[model samples]
Target chain A: MAKTTTPPDQNGTKTLSDQAYQRLRSDIIHGVLQPDEKLRVEHLRQEYGVGASPLREALSRLTADGFVTAEGQRGFLVAPMSEEDLADITRLRILLEKQALCQSIESGDDAWESQIVAAFYQLEKVEESTDRDPVEWEVRNHDFHEALIAGCTSKWLRRFYSILYDQHKRYRNIALSTEIPRDLHQEHEELRNAALERDQKRAGDAIEHHILRTAEITQRVLREESLQKKERA
Target chain B: MAKTTTPPDQNGTKTLSDQAYQRLRSDIIHGVLQPDEKLRVEHLRQEYGVGASPLREALSRLTADGFVTAEGQRGFLVAPMSEEDLADITRLRILLEKQALCQSIESGDDAWESQIVAAFYQLEKVEESTDRDPVEWEVRNHDFHEALIAGCTSKWLRRFYSILYDQHKRYRNIALSTEIPRDLHQEHEELRNAALERDQKRAGDAIEHHILRTAEITQRVLREESLQKKERA
Candidate 1:
């Protein structure tokens, strides 16, 4: 869990562009940078205290990653969010994650089980704490899910999983609220148990249902938020 | 089909970096650039006749696209190839393409069917030609496949398909030999017929088998090449 959130000092080998890419990606996912916001190189340079060259490089990379959209010479924008986009992301996550979970169940060793236990335990600690930050909770939750698929040997599948997961996280972060709709901890526990038991079908069903359920909640939240915005308008 | 192969003069909106990215990606996929080859920016700048800034930006974007890998400050390299990677890419292509094909079948309009017909026609024409370039065949084949899933509404699914298809193309190009391993024309025809008839299961199975069979051939080629290298050593 400690490895999930990096302190700035730990980035010794990271180039300035890599650092900028991480910062920009996190800001976009966490909603520090609003969706559809124009990213002017000059303005971002001042804001991030990064030079223009590295900033452009970072934005180019993020464009490839789907976090940013390049608008030709006009520069980039934080990719916009939509209900359909969230649904698409959810669909992909379910498809890829289910396959990955089944593979992990087949191949996961004792160390894999220990990682899952540790990740889930960390997530539970955060969930049980009343004063935990939402960002911290999101990080822990991400690590827990990552741990489940850590044993999958297919790099391509894992890469797609990472991309879809990040996109899902973006939607989750944007639609996040204080309302606790589902028993998240229970869901996590079920997923962990299913994986540890090596029940591929149960694990697959658990993750699919978990992701679909989360998408439903997020979609509802998005709808209500859009309606509120309309009312305000 | 013409849109699949870009003519240099028509790239009006493309920046120098975009040009570099396209050139480098095509070279890598076509095996003009060998796997694990170091991409020295200074050498590439001389060869590509592009400035350093845009070249670096292009390389950064390619890194995210998985065609090139950045090694901290050590610069970039063409991503390596392996039997496992081709297997993984084929597996993912089957999963995502099958879904996309189904969605396209469900949602496709008359226009979508027409596009498929046209693309298939072009592909057949290329296949029947006596002096057709392999690159031309690849382009038509790509367009034909693209036309099949053009009606799928999910942008994310299409994006993943594009990525996986490109990676698969890289493997296909590298393992390419003059050997006619299978009747590719017959397979394409079956896929077209299934897609046009909206037979989801048949289309899905056809594509799954098609991709798997191609992977088997590519794997055999890679194995034989490695063996030849060992003999030379």
Candidate 2:
């Protein structure tokens, strides 16, 4: 779980740009940087205590990842969020995730099984805690899902899945869900059980339903928030 | 079709970095830059006739897009190739392309249908001519496929689809197929008609088979080439 939160820091090899990349990625995903906010290089340098070159390097990389948008010479901004983008992310996540879940179930050995268990255990700890931070919960939840699919050997699939997950997380963070509409624990347990039993179809269906439902719940909340803002305006 | 080839260049606002990004992307996708080859900053500076800053920025962006690998202080390298990667790319492509095709079919307007027709016509023109450059055919083929899914309103899906397409193109260029087994023309026609007719299931199945068969053919050719090289060694 700890490993999943921040990638293992490659000591002696982490360049300044790499540091800035990690910082900016965490900041964006954790919602410290708001959606569609301008990411000026000078301001970021002052905020991150890093130099201009590395900050530019980080933002450029983020731009390529779709986490940040390059506004030509105008600079970069946090990738904007909307209902449409969230729905698209959810659709792609369901597609890629189900595929990954199926592959992991078929190809995962005992070691893979244990990783899933460990990840689930950590997530359960966070879920059961009443005082847990939303961001922490998100990280733990992310680790569990990632662990479930870690057995799949396709790097490209995993890469795309994680990118979607992060983008989705930025949305999830901004619009926090206080009351999940589904049997969240049961859903996770069923997914873990189906994968463990090597019931690939069941696992895929479980994940697909889970992801789709989450999207619906989040979108409803987002719509309400926007409506409230409109009323205030 | 032309709009699909390169994302309609932002009129007059294409920065030096943007130019470098496009140039390097084209070179890597078209196999002008070989895999695992070093991308020295100074050489690219001279070759691209751009300052080092923009070239570095371009490479960093490409690194995030997975076309190029950044090697810490060792600079960058063109992303390496492998059978595993091509298989993953093909699998993800089918998943994404099928979804996009379904969305396009469900929501596409008359304009979308016309674009598909026009793109197919251009591709046919190139396919029928024996004297055309393979690269030109590649461009037409890309546009035709892009036009097929032009109606999918999901920017994320389209963005991921294009990235996968570019990565797949890199593989296609690396292992040029001397003998294509699939009826390439028929596949394109089916894709075009399926979209126009709004036949979602057939479109999905057609694209799945098309992509899978292409993958098998490319993998076979790649394996043969590697084996011959080994034998020579």
Error of 2 at A91 (Å): 1.2
**Model 1 chain A weakest lDDT span, ten residues long:** A1-10
lDDT of 2 by residue, A109-165 (tens): 999999999988988888777786666777788889988998888888888888999
lDDT of every predicted structure (CA atoms): 0.89, 0.85
Clash totals, every prediction? 0, 0
TM-score of each candidate?
Answer: 0.92, 0.90
Question: Cα deviation in Å at residue A21, candidate 1?
Answer: 0.8
Give TM-scores of the second chain, every candidate: 0.91, 0.89
Clashing pairs in 1: none
Top candidate on lDDT is 1
Task: For model 2, name the residue pairs that clash.
Answer: none
Residue range B56-141, candidate 1, lDDT tens digits: 99999989889999998799999999888888888889999999999999999999999999999999998888887787888998
lDDT of candidate 2 at residue B159, scale 0 to 100:
87
Error of 2 at A44 (Å): 1.4
